[model samples]
Target: MDLPNTEAVGAIVALLLARTKRGDGMKPWVRLVVPLCIAVAWVHSPALAQQPAKDPRIGFLWSGVAEAAAVRMNAFLEGVRGALRAQGDHIELVARIADGNQARLPTLAAELVAGKVDVLFAAGPAAVRAARAASPSVPIVALDLETDPIEAGLIAGLSHPGGNLTGVFFDFPDFGAKWLQLLRDAAPKLSRLAVFWDPSTGPMQLKAVEAVAGSMDVHLSVIEVIDVGNIEEAFRTAAKQKVDGLLVLSSPIFGSSPAMIADLALRDRLPAIMLFPEFAQTGGLLAYGPNLIDLFRQSGTMTGKVLAGTAPADLPVERPARFQLIVNLRTARTLGLDIPPSLLIRADQVIE
Candidate 1:
């Protein structure tokens, strides 16, 4: 018969002796119950360690489906994902598409807040305004807007954005210079220039148009397109006015009708300048503006920084660093406009 080692046997006897002494000092049942209690507590310890931690949710709102807005949204989201990966943070986005109806923004903002999003990202002036009105405590990052944040009451000032709202400001007021230069390049003899804008949402944009138009010494005709249904009438008026060329503003109302506007300009054989490159793709003669996608990606950088614990207010509003000039050769040929070699060389994309 195999026998246990003397050392092991002695250890076992010692443990039994200790237990016997404890049982004698108390009751046998109490001695037996102590080990069971210790085992139960040890089994439950893991449940405490597995308690869930909080995850952050982000909210996004857009004014409309203009090509610029779409591109910017995509770029921003791509950046958001990249930033989250680098920071090891999990984020959920609550998004709403308002389609240029500023009036609908309040309801959308309310819904995001009700969903308890940790923060919000507003794309334009209308979205920023709605978000600001919805919650004063939740942080917001507004991107590529045409209006002054302070003027729109979205912030107290640019340096402080003075509340929970902060992000890139495209300084729409500066586009006046770029728009006029692009117009002159596309249509050298374009004596009469007609600007189509909305009086309600485009006053700030109009100010930009007027400032540059005045400086450029071009004949500026402002045709106000307020009702969305009356956009065709506005285009018809531009065509009837015998304007040498038409310059479109970067407004949601104008952007939503890009294909129609391109068709109108093409049908009329009028050289037109588009605010977004996709307009040139849709047949506008030329497009010269900031690469909206870059602006959006920049916004994502700010969002990532905020998520990483940097204060939004401490981050300065970024300006557009990269701009593009895209000329559509097909549209140019159809409009019978000869694009100068110099301008063509400067263009980022020359579409044939």
Candidate 2:
């Protein structure tokens, strides 16, 4: 009903004819009618009233076993929810947990792709690989990718990720050295270091820590933890061999069974080092690594951007900026190990 443009068009036509010399028998009204029609069409066009944006449906898949990671999943989803809220993006999250079963991941990843989620959210290199393999066209946002995404063929490059995968790189190369140094400080006489790692994903981690151990004159007995069932035996063997300290590498099994591993470490009375602060919260002696919750929030923010029309290839891969050293003083006292004041002061968190 409001023909604002039509009114302006009439005024312009009138001004043009008044200034121009008259043509031979030209219909001056003809020029005005043509301009009026063009203006009318533009004013009534649907382009002005654009369609409202829809909320994204995010498919979130984690590497840890489903049952063992409910709390961790909830915490991650909470971070996602908080971040999306901050970005003013609403989402419908479709979540699937691998339940510490690596075999289930490929199948689950395929299912998410088939479900046609707007964005795929995952943790770890294995899960991201599965998702990328499932659908190269679908956008993927991953956190805690320990492997190099470029070499792993998950992305084209770090800055201009040409593929769908982009998120925080989780591998802290100095992580192994930091853990070993902390363990040494906690137990100065530590000679033999028992290193527990998942056979499936931690070969590189073992080599890195082994080099550090060799330099410190500490002998390392590398033990493989294949599953939750094998964890107790790993600690038992460490104790049997009189290992003075332990370094538990990051793995789905280790993450899924934190309480069990922490209890076992206490039972063996071995000072242990872990990656996430959650381990120390669960009574593990010490944790030195990235702030996982912050990483999760980073993933959440990136996912929101993808849903809001940003291509995954345009977003650069990121590395974590938050790292923490967490120490459980009660666990230290129970093991009869006095944590050095210097190390305690340096800790980002000291849990009594």
Candidate 3:
């Protein structure tokens, strides 16, 4: 058998070592390994001539329901996987369910960074913030984050992330207007609207609620539930105030407790509008917002670009171009209200 060229192997190894050292900011002792690696490459070429290069390892750090709830989060993960598979990259997922535990994030971030993943998928704002804190150089694609990336200093702007982070923004503020409009249209006689949110998880939700509450001519009742234990108390207050309609703010907490909240609303016979279709389908009256599956698929597109050697900063942050409005006819019927035919026609989906 003809042996591979040792000189060529040495040259390739040396080139790789230089790039690695520069990128990793290695100390002198570690830097000395470059020469040693090249020497070994020259000597080992004959035996390792046909060895396949190890595929790059990518990591996914998911918050919310990508690992559990089996909602739109799962769709986003599948979409991201499909995109990376098209580009021939190997990916692995590490999920941490804070389950509303904000304190666990730093530890979770440490674990992913310790694994030395080539790239990362940060699934929500909390996960993204954690990943950013953990790794400064590794490329990150953020999915479903509901903050203004610029204001949060996650990116320089929508058009330029200007760092190792970039992906799609959920544009929560714009959706706030749409969500309020959906609420008003669903219950035209809505007098007082109670807004429910988890302060730890729903900053954008609260801001949006305040911004449009006045224009809709409905008295806004800001109900905050900082922990899982406070949810019932928050609802009791809403009920006592005789809130005509309830608008559940979009948040990781709401996403986590969709079934429970939906059931409570149905049992209480409250006319509720939400921001996700799955929430409305479970028992809430309606939902109006972007399709999370499509957003996740778009996140996959960004992952593909990063794996293809494009910098995360080079890929501009994307705003969802499409949105969806869904109404649950069963919930409408239970509430003893007739949904206008025009509204039904405008719905992307009407769950009967």
Evaluated with TM-score, which candidate comes out highest?
A: 2
- Evaluated against the true structure, the overall lDDT of model 1 is 0.69
lDDT of 1 by residue, 91-207 (tens): 555566555555667877888889887778887666777888899888888874476666766667677665688888766676766777877887788778888776545377777
User: Clashing pairs in model 2?
Assistant: 64-100, 65-99, 65-100, 66-99
Taking every candidate in turn, the Cα RMSD to the unseen true structure, in Å, is 18.3, 18.3, 10.0
Q: Once superposed on the true structure, which residue ranges of model 1 sit more than 4 Å away at CA?
A: 1-49, 66-72, 87-89, 150-160, 172-174, 200-202, 212-217, 226-230
Model 3: how far residue 147 lies from native, Å: 0.6
The regions of model 2 sitting more than 4 angstroms off are 1-55, 67-71, 78-90
Candidate 1 global TM-score: 0.77
Per-prediction count of colliding residue pairs?
A: 0, 4, 0
- Please, what is the whole-model Cα lDDT of each candidate in the order they appear? 0.69, 0.73, 0.68
**How well is each residue in 40-136 modelled by candidate 3, as lDDT tens digits?**
2344345665554445545656545323433443454456555555443234443444445545556666776787766787766777888899989
Pick by TM-score: 1 or 2, better one: 2
